[model samples]
Target: MRLVSVDIDGIERPGAVVTGPDGVDRVLELRQFTGAGSLALLLADDVALDLTRTAIGRADHASLPRLADVRLAPPVRPQVILCLGYNYRGHVEGHHEGHVDGETGQDALPYPNVFVKTPNTIGGPHDRVVMPIAATDVDYEGEIAVVIGRTAQAVDESDAMSYVAGYTLFNDVSDRGWQDRSSQWALGKSVDGFGPLGPWIVTTDELPDLGGLQMEVEREGVVTVRASTDSMVYGVAFLVHYLSQIITLQPGDIISTGTPARSVQAQSAHLPLADGETVTIRVTGLGELTTTFVR
Candidate 1:
């Protein structure tokens, strides 16, 4: 089942996408349930999303709003946005000029390189991201974002997957100039609206296996980044378990798995995103996110 946050009379409400009786995809009003399925109840009551899934299967379609009519909000307003750096094997293993040598890259890292971006960085999946005045080279990092379902601390690697709620797409936009100017990347990475996350959340139950999943990013109609989760140095389970040991993860928290290096298509013409241009990230089975850049 796909879960979405929707704009209802200027309020953010939980919704489920289901096919209408007439075969049109529509958004089911989850809040009307006053039960487990509501975003409020689901999170605070720890209600099983199974209830929502079941409802979607048998929802009354006549009253539901067509997907095209309801404005979407970012799937979840995460309390904290955790990010991984250089987590992809392609990035660590001989990706670009002066990149790490393949022989010593993957195993050389002792732990996942983690970073934090504030919740303010979140934006609607189709929102316009304004180019920072100080930025000269605006770049995008397409990532698979993991949304945590339960509170966890020091969970075993074997059991970490259980904490996941669902998956969404994220574009980690950055100012290459600001990023390279200092050893610290916070300024470059945490600009408001830098992270465009979600059209909706595809529940983990629908996609439990990630070993061979593909994620790609397109810019100017060219597939700039194409990668598989199999290329990650630290798998999702490992990263979750490792981070849980350090900090407690709560429901609605997100972990953005790092991106792979640019594909050969992008390397040949490495131009930064310009005003009015758009970037799209697609993850098979998850969803797609498109962000337009603006001045």
Candidate 2:
């Protein structure tokens, strides 16, 4: 099921979208059955997912809305956003030391490069991201994000995926100037509206084999970045297990798994995002998320 948080009559509500018997796309008002007001609450426990699936089985046609009529919000309200930098092998491309080897050598760190983004940085899928005045070279990093299902600490990779609620698309917009000023990435990555998330969240049961999914990003209708999740140096299971050892992963906390190769800086001929431009990213099965850049 494709779950979404939508704005109806100025009120944000949780919904489950499905194709009705009439062959039309529709969203089932999940709040009624789950007894939860928002998607965040619906994802808080396993019971809610079971209740949602039961409702969908015998849902009333009138309760469903045309998918296009609904305005979407970020599917979940996360307490903190964690992103992995350079988790993909080919994304660095000489921009950083030891990146060329692509994690083959013994010198690589045991843990991944993890960074944090403030909750305020998150925006809806269709929202416009204002380019920061402090930096001129703004770029995009399209990645697969993991939504934690349960509180986790010191978990192993074998038990890591069991704690995941679902998956969503994330656009990790960054300002190269601020990002490169120091080794730290928060200042450049955590700007207000820098994180564009969601079309909806596809539960783990909905989309298996996430590691084999294809990812692509387009700028003004031109495909600039393209690769598959199989290229990630740190897979989802390992990332979850690694981070859990240091921090307690909570429900509704978001972790972006990192973008694939060919960001603007990684490509020799690629151009940076300019004012009034748009970037759209799609990961197979998760759906498309589009964000516009403005001065």
Candidate 3:
């Protein structure tokens, strides 16, 4: 089932997208059922979601709201946003002059190169990605974001997938100049609204093999990034397990599994995002997320 955070009548509530009796998609508000303030609050409430899913399946059409009437939020307000750097072969070994070599001599890196972005970075799926004054060459890194369902520490790779609640789309907007200037990436990555995530979270039950999904990003009607989740140098299960060893993974914490190699820098013209241009990231099963850039 697809879970969404919705804004209706100035109140934010948790909802699920379900087809009604008319065979039309509608948003079923789960507030009455789950008694949760937000979707983020329900990540660990698996039993609540399971029951809600069953109820939604048999819910009356008259009781549901038209999907168009509700405004979508960022889906979840994550407590922490951990991002993987150079997990994709194409991104690590870019098709450019300054690309890094991906030959680690091993099948994968010893561990995932992880970085943290502040909570302020989160923005609604369709929200505008503000071009900060500190930024000049802002580019998009469209990725698949994993939401943790339960608290975990030192979880085994074999069981890490069980901790995942769902998947969502994320755009890791970066300032190329700032990113390259320092050895650390947080300065270039954590500007407010830099992380545009979600339209909704697709429960892992509906998408078991998360790595098999396809993802792509578009800018001004041109497809710029295209790749499959299977291309990650360190796949989802490994990253989660590795991260758990260092820090406890809590519900609503997001791990943005690395992005594929496609960005404005890859354009023949070498252009970064400009004001008024919109970037749309689409992960096959997870819904599309759009972010318009602004000054």
**Candidate achieving the largest TM-score:** 3
Can you list the residue pairs that collide in candidate 1?
A: none
lDDT of 1 by residue, 112-166 (tens): 7777887888998757998868778888889988888888799999999998887
Which residue pairs show collisions in model 3? none
Q: What are the models' TM-scores?
A: 0.90, 0.90, 0.91
Residue pairs in candidate 2 whose N, alpha carbon or C atoms collide under 3 angstroms: none
- What would the C-alpha RMSD of candidate 2 be, to one decimal place? 3.0
Query: lDDT tens digits, residues 127-199, model 2?
Result: 7999867766788888888988788799999989898889999998887767767766667787888898898
Pick by lDDT: which candidate is best?
Answer: 3
Q: Candidate 2: where are CA atoms >4 Å away?
A: 33-36, 93-107, 263-266
Using TM-score as the yardstick, the better of models 1 and 2 is 1
- Local error of candidate 3 at residue 69 (angstroms): 2.2
The Cα local distance difference test for each model comes to 0.79, 0.80, 0.80
Report the Cα lDDT for residue 174, model 3. 82
